[model samples]
Structures are given as structure tokens and as C-alpha cells.
Target: MLSMVRRPNPVQWLRYAAGGRLPDHLREWVLRDVTTRTWFLRGAARSSLLVLPLSSVWLLLPGPLGLRLSLCLMALLVGYFYSLAYLEESCEHKLVKHGYRYGSGRATRNAAKDALEAEAHARYVARYRN
Candidate 1:
């Protein structure tokens, strides 16, 4: 179980973002197997960096409207990024909704490996047997 007060550090968070589980400092949040492709894709989708450049579009408006629009866009960007970044601490209860649960990274990887190995072993047995 995760501590109510203690939060995962940046390094641990990086592990999570990389589609791995948090270190021992944090418990497993994901229950099912997850592939790196899915992990990276989700992280990329959650990224707020896209708005940084898009917000600049307001700057090209050429008047006070541009200034106001730019400020608004910047503000929106900040709020968006803030929410996305802090989702971990404030996000525990909601992880299930996204189909991720905190769990041991090693365990997950081992499970995948075991599954693959089992499949391979089965194939070998079938091919060599009379």
C-alpha cells in the first residue's frame, strides 16, 4: 500500500513514466501486464509540451487581443501541465480508471518473460516430439 503522505521521487516517477513500476518506495499500481509501447504512448498523450508552441499562436494576433489571448493560452497551458504532472499523488484513486495499477516492475517484466518462455518451450516440445 502507498503511504498517504509520502510521495514517489522523480526517479521513481521516471520509472512509472517509462512503463515500469515505482521503486520499493512506492507500491505496484498496475495489476495487468503492460507493454512498453502502451506505456510510452500513454505518457506521450499525457504530455503538455505540445501546448507550449500552440499557445504562441496567440502572439501573432497583432494587438491587445493578442496579448490577452497569449496570456490566457499560457495560463491554460500552465494549469494543464500542472494537473498532468501531479496526477500521481492526487491520482492514486483514479489509476484504475486508466487501466494502470502500481505494482512491482520486476514482477511485471518477469511475468512477460515467463509467458514468452512458456510459449517457446511449448513450441520446442511440439516441433521435436514424434
Candidate 2:
């Protein structure tokens, strides 16, 4: 029997984190993995969205580095924050044994969602900037 708890499935989670748009055609293709089917680790691509930027920053830092290392560290911090914010947004719904609750009449939940979205955008830009 299926539990009443409707946990965030992989596609829904990634789509939520992507802010209602797939990052690219390749990413859209990967979303098909969300369906239960033959698979080798679903959601890997979406998880990489959370990883590649930080890994790039780490690899790009100058050796015996100057301000570049500091900059990369700062970039990592921003990525950390963006991940936290997105996680919070993706889990904002409170699942009770019976049903679910969102926002819950609290101004803070919506405030947090907005703040996280903005932070996610900022982090994306910082990571992708040439």
C-alpha cells in the first residue's frame, strides 16, 4: 500500500529547485528518469547542479593562490547558502500523517521562499559569471 505521505519526488524536487524551468534541453531529457523505470541513479543531473559550480570553483583557484583562492572560498560559501535555501524551499510543506500544510498562515514561510529564490539567482550568477 502506498503511504499517504506524498514526499517530494525527484522530478518535482528538481523542477522546484530550477524555479519552474529546466536548465537546458539535456536537463529536460533527464527529467524522464523521475518516472519509475529502468535507471541507474536518478536525479544525478539535478544533484550535479548543486555540485558542479563548487567543484569548478575549487579547480579554478590559483595555485599558492592570491585573492583568487579567497574568491573561490567565497563562491563556495554562496553555493552552500543557495543549497540550504533551495532545500528549505523544497521542504516548506509540512506533511502530517493525514494531509499536508504549507505556509501555515505564517508570513515567514513565504518570506523565506522569496529570500531563497533571490539567493539562488545570485549564486547562479556568481558561479556562472565569466
Candidate 3:
């Protein structure tokens, strides 16, 4: 039935964050971005990582207004990246369940082969007199 563990509540969420757990939504949301191969989500996650450090530094700059804005941005980015990481991990786990691995090989090869063989067999039979 594809049951997933429930997401943490607000208090637990805060506690998890405080205890150094990234604020990932967990479960299918993680897999949704990764296994589903959503380009937007993947790209956002990659770009977010690239930007995190720069944003951190920017928050430390001289201007108070800029610092406040940057801090807010940093928090936002952290949440985004946390979700991304969780999604990526979830997707990876899901893929592994189906015998897929990133950079291991083309995961769908067996399925493809089966499909092609079926098609070829049908075509061959269609062309025979019998």
C-alpha cells in the first residue's frame, strides 16, 4: 500500500532542526523530485547548494538592511535546500528499491530489452505464413 512515516509536527520540526537534522519534508516528497526526474526540482536543488555559501557571506556584509534581508533569504534557502536533499535521498532510495542507481548504468535496460523482444517476436510471427 506504500505507507510512509508521518511528517514531523512544528515542535518536532524545530527540535529536529535544532538537533542538526535538516528540515526535509521526508517520504515521497523527496522521491518525487528525484525518482520522478523533475528537472525544475533537481536544478533548484543544485543551484541552491551553489548559492548557500554566497548567501551566508552576503548576510555578514556591512549594511543592516541588507544583513536582515540576507538572513531571511538564508533561512528560506536553507529550508529549500533541506527539502531538496531529503527529496533526492528519498528518490535514491526508491530507485534502489527498483534496482536503479545513479551513475551505475542505464536502469531501465532490462525493461527495454523485454519490450523490444516482445515486439520483435510479434513482428516475426506477423510476417510468417502460419
Cα lDDT, all candidates? 0.52, 0.48, 0.51
Q: Candidate 3 residues 1-130, lDDT tens each?
A: 2355445566754443332232344533333324333534653554555455556665666788866686869676786776565654444444454344562223443455678899999999989945
Q: Write the per-residue lDDT of candidate 1 for residues 1-130, one digit (tens) a residue.
A: 3334345576755555544545443333332213322543444443444444556666666679857686867766785676567544433433443445644433455677799899999999999974
- For candidate 2, write residues 5-124 as lDDT tens digits: 244557856664454543343332322323223222333444457655665676565576666667676776676556555543333332211133553323444565678899999999
Worst 10 residues of 3 by lDDT: 15-24
Instruction: State model 2's lDDT.
Output: 0.48
Best by lDDT: 1
Q: Is candidate 1 or candidate 2 better by lDDT?
A: 1
> Cα RMSD for candidate 2?
17.9
Clashing pairs in 3: 30-87
Global local distance difference test of model 3: 0.51
Best-to-worst order by lDDT is 1, 3, 2
Residue pairs with backbone atoms closer than 3 Å in model 1 (clashes): 28-102, 28-103, 29-101, 29-102, 29-103, 30-101, 30-102
